[model samples]
Target: MQPLTAYCMRGHRQVEGWLQRGSLSILWSLLEAQRLHALAGDVAEIGVFHGKLFIALALSLTNEERAVAVDLFEMKRAPDFEQEFRSNLEQFSVPMDRVDIRRCASEMIALSAAPEIFGSNVRLFSVDGSHEYAAVIHDLNLARACISQVGIIALDDLFSAWSPGVSEAAIDFLRHPDNRDIVPLAISAAHGPLITGASKLFMVHASQVDFYASELMRMNRQSFKTRASFCGVKTLVFDFTNGVRKRIEFR
Candidate 1:
């Protein structure tokens, strides 16, 4: 086979780089900037790749705050996902004064891990471990249980087919009445269907023609480099008792 051209190589590198960084730092930064109460709750990360992001958060949190990290501490194809997350945290000079790493697999990200502690003050939760459907749901449910009241959980890979089940499970679960509190804070359009030609577009059970149109409209207006994402989700679980269709489509 002939040698690949420089342009093709560069494109390949960029794609690989994105997969490594996971979520944009700006999104996390915005969430962190919010005013938080002292000792409000714990800050946890299920997929602590290399602990860079985890370190970043730990460093930002106050001394009284708890930065609990859970990861395999083993690096895989995910370059940023360090095998030894603790080492990375140390390398980054992250003060462990408040950081507590569970050093466990995502299996810990379930109610079974700490059932009695359900609905605890887990102020912020970030999940980026498995890309499979079942795993994503487990993580989502776990995140739901841990998040504090009015807390926000950022679902990474909203745009990557590497985990189509993520968006699907999220939309489906959040559509339910029980999960009406889960809201979308800010969706990134960096990897949605409009830009990534995503084969699937997951809409919640309550999704309507107007909502669909609005999402599509947003996709169309976005710049070329920016991908259309679900941004923020507000739980508006409508009562089915009201004579309304489950789903609606508009021309």
Candidate 2:
């Protein structure tokens, strides 16, 4: 396995969260590619349950880049949520000084005030916060405002059986008259990009559609690939029918 894959796998297993194992390889591959292309910007994730995916993103950052983790950290089921999140970062040797932790509802914040909160030019944003329709729309707008030129938004629970609102909200968000320039790159489901184990839909600005779509195809890591319409935009779909593998490799 590649060193990134090994470390990501270790972190994914050790962390407490709801991320698919397959997502680690795909996320790491894309982030590394962004670095290779000199995409300099911060990374942010709303609703960081316990830093499972956040750690990998933070680790990928350059010395000048920062990672922001926004979460309410008050879920009844997740006792000591904030403490565990901090502990995980320390255990993984993440540079805590470079990470900004914000405790608030994502929708409560506005992008106009982002400079003080999220900074600017976010290259990669993970939108796993608030699966509700209105909240998803709000978060997407915020992401659109701060995304860098080569940025990609990773929206979790896109096709999840338990979170159908996520899919509804994504489609609704993209349909708005103001969002005509946004398009999806791929869906990390059984019928979409990457492999079958992930459950997020990756979207980007129309200008970036070809860039990410072509890159994912070039990777050639999917079991099957084809074209499909998601959120009213044409995109490449990759799927894996076999059970999760012991090891996954990304080109």
Candidate 3:
């Protein structure tokens, strides 16, 4: 596993967005580890509020890789979001050529010919778009369609009271037979007032669990020992002080 260096930590904090520092750390560490393991694929996100996390994904990409941003930028929920998104990316000096911004709802993008736009090699898919149950399920399906063999799909706000639907939808999707191939790797959450706080869930292929587990243990000693089983699925759950924890599971 690749260690989260000081420079990477600083870059994560420098980016402005809803992503907590700990979540950013985990994202950076995961991507770095993926790169080290030669898990080559494109990166993507569904709900880019501003270009904060999007920029982080962009920074992680190599010249041959691409990053896709899908969101209803001008919608009532976040008017002028695209403007800020563009500004932030520019401010961070992200290569505009490497990014493909899609201005539409996640459901719309999911229903379209997404693979043609984003390609079929998605190693990291971040689902932070709609908090509604149906929307979450749709996004997960889309993520599954494009995710590489060793790719990871990250679901945001899994346990946040503000969007309990996300958790319900994710659990439901996991239980469904159609999604049997998409297994959980870890659920990252922070220790906090349960309801208001949020958690991020990382998932991957069932066959890749041992690889991720070994790498995760190498990176964080505190994470390796904390294990649990859900619905017969074994998971490694890790909690951080900043209210960030990851529960990795396998089928």
Candidate maximizing lDDT: 2
* lDDT tens digits, residue span 25-114, model 2: 556657767866788899999988878889888887786899999999988666558989999888877888899999999978986876
TM-score of 1: 0.61
Query: Which ranges of candidate 3 are over 4 A from the true structure?
Result: 1-8, 75-78, 110-112, 191-197, 223-225, 242-251
Please report the TM-score between candidate 3 and the true structure.
0.87
lDDT of 3 by residue, 156-218 (tens): 887787888998998898889987877887766655554323678888888888888677765
Worst 10 residues of 3 by lDDT: 242-251
| Model 1 ranges off by over 4 Å | 1-23, 36-39, 75-84, 108-112, 115-119, 191-251
TM-scores for the candidates:
0.61, 0.88, 0.87
Q: Which ten residues in a row have the lowest lDDT in candidate 2?
A: 189-198
Per-model CA lDDT versus the true structure: 0.48, 0.75, 0.74
How many collisions between residues are there in candidate 1?
Answer: 15
Better of 1 and 3 by TM-score: 3
Q: For model 2, what is the alpha-carbon lDDT of residue 192?
A: 38
